[model samples]
Target chain A: MLSEPLIERLTETPLFAVGLTLAAYLLGMALFRRLKQPPWLPGILMAALLLAGFLAISGIHYTAYQDGAAWLSVLLGPATVALGMPLYQQLPRIRELWRPLAICLPISASLAAFYAVGIAKLMGASDHVMASLAAKSVTAPIAIGITEQLGGSVALLMGALLITGVAAIAFVSLVARVMKIRDERLIGFALGLNGHALGTVRAFEIGPTAGAFASLGMSLTGIFTALLLPLAWRLLGG
Target chain B: MAALSGFLWLISFWLIGEVVVYFTVLPVSSGVIGMLLLCITLALRGGVPESVACAAQPLIALLAMLIMPGVVGVFFIAGELVGQWTAILVGLVLGTLLSVVTTLWLMQRLMRGHHAE
Candidate 1:
């Protein structure tokens, strides 16, 4: 039902792929806001599904989509750096809470990695699968590098990372409520420590202070886990 | 122009971070290093620059969208995912929950200690 020129333009041009991503995300944002921002329907997940569905229906490869979307991906680095603004705004509190935060972040990050690999091993997963799962809680950029160093499949690591992020966003509120967690800082730190970037999104929704702490947790987790995972792997003789 | 300037500054910080990581033995990513550098700068300056805040606001606003491309990469390996679905799912859920609970408990314990002091 499509014209030859239109199909050609879509497949051959970069604009179509880039536009597709933005359009999908915009629609996801609209729906998310309209629906009162449910945790399960986080904008990124919905947008990814929409984009993935579009690619599936059109028979286009993800690599083709990446051709146009790569520009947006490049910004992830700067956006990450930009997180310093809010964190700087809340630096005093972060300083005051540094003792607890510094102590808790590395422990939780290692625990997340250890528990993930442990469960994977119990479930009879191969070493590569275990390695991929070990870095599930860190942000994608750092995670990909860690996975490479640990000799895991990059595709599997990417999938597991998103899965952990979505799960963290969806279940965090319930977990906090059940645990009787009321302090926003603690809640944010927990989310960021476990969830990474997606968790930071949820923390922002809770409050600015929470968002700041979440950013702190995310950064610290990335730093600690990246340094420690390889050392831990060597210690385990992997 | 302020937003543009802020954007450039953030990118420069990122570049600095990349250079630092390239030279150093630290395992942290350049983006995070940039964030730390900027945080220290802001703290020393007594506040964040208006320009940086302006640029950072919109980027943070759509932070989810920025990461979507990587997430969409998931579609490419659907076969592997289906095969490993059970183990991956169980591991993710357990790992995330355990991390959350332990961090919360330890944080509270530490905070209580500080209060007692």
Candidate 2:
């Protein structure tokens, strides 16, 4: 019923893109709840997929959507800064567990990167792709920079990172159950460090203290891995 | 004075991360390095200013949204991505599985240590 130009202009708006993303996220959330899957599964990745599909079906250029989605992107800076508040509130517990977390985060984060890269290589992926995939479990922005520096595809790395988050959301509970990990602090921290945002959400649901630790782990892991990955790459001649 | 210090702290954290990445052979980012530097500072200093913490809270809360622009940027390359869909799908699935298993295994070890202690 709409004119072609009208539809084009409508889709080009940032609000439309944000709306679509939010709708997809809500849909994913509904499906997750219905299927008894974890919140992160539907909340983030599904929203991404749905948006991807919408663009595909509509034959709309990604550049068009970019106009609308950039606003959402700007929020990332503030969101990252805001994470400090929650961590600040949990200072007492963080203080108590400082030594343990300090030791655990670096080791865990490094292994996660190593294993991801090793397996990707074993699966016969190209060397560049492997490099990009290495930092997928780290947060998105950091992963992008690392992927670019390693001479890998940023597109591939972003896809890998989102998938990593989804996988973490999907399997974290099962892993927790199988491993019999009881301490909320450790579970949440491990999740955040290795899983990033999705893992942080899971940690929050577990408990506020656990959520705080998860943020700590997520922030620390991102920082440490970012610093370490570049050095590791150069050492490997990447 | 406290607010000024907090702002300075944030900048220092960012710079430290950049320096580490620039100097190191690793494939990591300066921002991430900055985050680690901040964590260490917190650990050593005990805590940041309450006002600083408050200011940072809102930013962290929306951290995920900050990255959305990059994600949306993917739409611009959706054509290329679609062309490589099969490889991307394979990579995502396998990479995710590998991350989960490895993280869980490591977490279990950490949990075991916690329980033992």
Evaluate every candidate with DockQ and list the scores. Answer: 0.62, 0.32
> What is the overall TM-score of model 1 with all chains considered together?
0.89
User: Which candidate number would show the highest TM-score if scored against the true structure?
Assistant: 1
lDDT of 2 at B107: 59
lDDT of 2 by residue, B19-89 (tens): 67578744555555555455556667776666567556555654554555455455556565444455555
**Cα-based TM-score, every candidate:** 0.89, 0.73
**Error of model 1, residue A100, in angstroms:** 1.7
Segments of candidate 2 deviating more than 4 angstroms? A1-40, A81-95, B1-30, B33-55, B72-117
Number of backbone-clashing residue pairs for each candidate, in the order shown: 0, 36
After the best TM-score superposition of candidate 2, give how far the Cα of residue B57 lies from its true spot, in angstroms.
3.6
Per-residue CA lDDT of candidate 2, range A1-238, in tens?
4456876888755788777766766775677677776554544555566667777677666667666777776444333333444555566776776666666677778877877676656666567667777777777766666777778776566666677776776666777788676777766776787778777877788898678777777766776776678778889875
Quality of model 2 by C-alpha lDDT: 0.65
